[model samples]
Target: MNLLDKFDAVTVEADFRITPEDKAFCEAHQAAYDAAIQSFHELAFFWEDMENTQKELLGSKEDTYLSSRDGPEISQRRINAHLEWLHRAVISNIVYHFNSTYHVSVRDDYVANNLLPQMPDLRIYENKEAREAYHKKLREAKIRYEDVFDQMLLLLDGRSFTEQAFHELAEKCHKAAWNLYQNKANYERKKALISFNGYFCSLHHYSWQDEWTLEDKTQDILRGVAHYETGSFDVYPLGFSELLGYQRSPNNEHEFSTCKKVKGLKMFKNGRVDIRFTSETYAAEFATRYLGLVC
Candidate 1:
């Protein structure tokens, strides 16, 4: 017989003794598989929607000439909306799979590799209170799936994998995603550090304070400026300043400058700071402390 006919003949001649319990088990497995597929379809739809929103936001910038003054504000609103949608997409994926009986490993892998890494700083621009609420939710989700995630991670780490190719692939994908995230984080940190010198120069020109104090209000202002410059809300600007040896005065108040005077331009002019000091004594101090440069 031909291949198709031989397969059919074999099926017809099969004397498989199927019991009622075996049939029930097969049906249950099929049902679970169907549910898993459906969950994936829903995730696909969420991703498509997210991509469309991002595209629309990018397209909105095409009319830059018309809305030159309001362009940034409009772009920011769209960006916030996109971030909110992304947060919802992640939460939806986790919730859907968490409720599923099958493919628990997939859910665990996603949470451990993707969601947990981004927790506490998921790019959501909510207020401190709102961010805390989301953090609580994330913590609960992690607790729920952490055991399964650990089990799967251990299983995927085995040296011999004859039938675990799929698990291996999942591990590789997770690692790649994590690496991409780390690279992005490194890029942001570098950019933020580079911009700090410029921001310090600008601060000298403000006439707001003769000497910068490390107060809560100062920290908040620095945070806002850093956010404006780098589009990063994750890094603490004050922490960067501390790393540069810019400590608060002993009395926790602003004080006059103590560094020895250089021959060139004064760091501050007309009650404002000069930008050129980026290469002067201040820059030397910053490099020595922040960049670990001996000079």
Candidate 2:
């Protein structure tokens, strides 16, 4: 099953007892649901785009038309790289935000305000030990909700990716693209293309690129730290000289290095860092050491 199916199944299990409070919680968090729907629609649109690009590339037999300034093979490789990047971006958005954001919000909000308040009342159980067990069950349920919520938050924030879900999405996009491309029925092709383009147009009013901003200080620092830790970076800040002192030296002309060093600082090559804690600590430590250098 796809991520959405799995999400729905878990939700069904999680929704064993739905009260008026739950309904109110969902209503309060309608914006989150709207965001998720928008995200999913974008994901579907990009999936079609990726598939159509692949189909076009595959359908072409002549190398002359595909040739660029580099060569036909190089040009083709670039196109493939772009298509792959597009697929990854779409999958990232879906796995991170589209699939679970609203559900997580609803679950968390419901538990916090509704279910948690009833924890003290143990009519579900008789003795003290039984009451404790019931409380434990409630806590466990909350944790389950939080665990998935945090995981999705991490994914959406670009701290991690759901590998299995991503692969599944990629496969689905490829299959759909191929099927549509290979379809000989003109009417069917026209219908499918229209549907695909319609979804894309629906979201065309919003610029996805605006979601990533270099001017956002918090994002810039977090992205810089992520790059420093993992070598995987985004376009944020465009440079890291101010925050990380990363600059190229004229003497070397080919090598880049930091201008200053901070003590008690450790860096990693793999594993995700908690952006909230790491970014704050890194900034404070750097500022302290920077002042020490100046003094």
Candidate 3:
């Protein structure tokens, strides 16, 4: 059968696929997909014009900031932003488009089913050397950002929309657009998670684990009881084999959701769980919930 036929087959088989709850989510995804395509066209045109202008200005030098090294620095920043935007938009579009087309769960159903490509760890972009190495790898493979755009167009055209087709195109576009940034890919994967291992150990009245100090600072989240950053820790309450979800206090009826101001919970094997709070208020709240103490 053709690609369109496969889609129709899936849709017919799952007649009860989209629920009433999915209406808003599906519409939101559609809106985002439309906006992302528009942004891609805008960025591509702007980048082309900027690249040409930079090339023309190469021989002209002056003491002014615009004519000095700042000019190139500013240009690089713009290019970097463009690349980052593309990377995010492409991934989002693929996920959203797949869900929208099939009327599937508008969440990360593609991700869970392995239909989308895995994103590179955001930390990889933080290192200049690593970025250059990745750029070289892309060059060796002869990949370009334009190829990613082409794949996007193909996917949008309804020519091939099966899961396998999406997977192939997503992998190609993800790699191409990611490599487009090179040394300038500085997208933050999550909130800033600083190491508080020292503080954690000190608070618990225990000695610090040397291994915790060596955890990669670039990772937005680290999982382990011993970590000082964004990961969760495993906590065993008295007579309980499982760790607490950190959802609520022993007596409270309400559950606390992990958010920007009150982030909590993760576990590394054979290590204690840890928590990171944005402010002293939340920190104290966490203390009261789990530790049975006020901060």
Candidate 4:
């Protein structure tokens, strides 16, 4: 049977199982895993210290820390100054650890590497109103974290890290290291698509608001019909032969040309893409090439 016909007849899920080699690779990077856990512990220590000091000075009063209305000006100054110094020390510690471990050279890199949960600024505490506003923002801001450090610190309730927490943190670190390996490996697998496969691949994920040059190029090259929805643009590469370069002869092309439909091609504003395929094989192929996988 024709491969495309088979694709048309079935659904496929990409096999993203961590192979033995991948597991071995993760094992090799045990140092990076250990370093990540240590980083989390250090941040948790700082957070606990901050929490204790804040409780001691404020005594359960929102209007007492640096509030001119509730405390003497000198008292407010002293408390604010001490808190500011502590905050700076904590930030400095985090910055130095990430720099040494991950070689994070810029502030944005911290966000990229999933290092810090909230990017706290001490300048927000420069005045009474500013301090109050900052506290309000913190109260309203959702507590969330991607890495173990942020997860533990944000959720810490002034208690010591228990053995279970340590075990859970270690488990999360293992998963994170494995995920990094998977992304690196899958990225390499898809790298061939840009070369011999005649697919245009971009590493930078474009925002919905940002100009996507690839959309224009896709229109110009494939001359495909583009349908724009409220949040996304779908391009049908009917003239895919010009871009795929495999339609010239069936002898030279893989099954991709046979199943040329780029149906339900969703560019998820992030650096990921998803396409609906009639055949599971095609779907798996497309998914392994484009979609982000988490393990």
User: Global lDDT of each model?
Assistant: 0.34, 0.32, 0.36, 0.34
lDDT of each residue in 1-295, candidate 4, tens digit only: 5212232222233232334643454344444434544554455556556656877887765443433566544443344434333333333444344333322232433432343234346775667787676544432332112232343333332222232222222233223222344333222222223111123323332363232222322222222112111111223333333333222211212232333433333233333333344455544443332222333
- After superposition, the stretches of candidate 1 with alpha carbons farther than 4 Å from their true spots are 1-14, 59-295
Q: Write the per-residue lDDT of candidate 1 for residues 50-146, one digit (tens) a residue.
A: 5567668777445333235545333333433443344334334433442232222333345444544354554563568767666445433322223
Displacement of the residue 37 alpha carbon in candidate 1, Å: 1.0
Better of 1 and 3 by lDDT: 3
lDDT of 2 by residue, 1-295 (tens): 4322332221111222223643354344444444444554455566556656766887645343324676534333343334333322323333334235232222223223332324455455567887766544532332223233344444333312333233233233323222344432111111101111111111011343211112222223333334333333332223344323332122201112331221111112121111221234544432221111111
The residue pairs found clashing in candidate 1 are 204-273, 205-273
Top-lDDT structure, candidate number: 3
Number of backbone clashes in candidate 2: 0
Evaluate candidate 3 by giving its C-alpha RMSD to the native, one decimal: 19.3
Best by TM-score: 3
Please write out the lDDT profile of model 3 over residues 117-208, one tens digit for every residue.
33356797678887766544432232222333234434434333333333332233222212233522111122322222321211112254
Give the lDDT of residue 47 in candidate 3. 64
TM-score of 4: 0.19
lDDT against true structure, model 1: 0.34
Winner on TM-score (3 vs 4):
3
**Model 4 global lDDT (CA atoms, 0 to 1):** 0.34
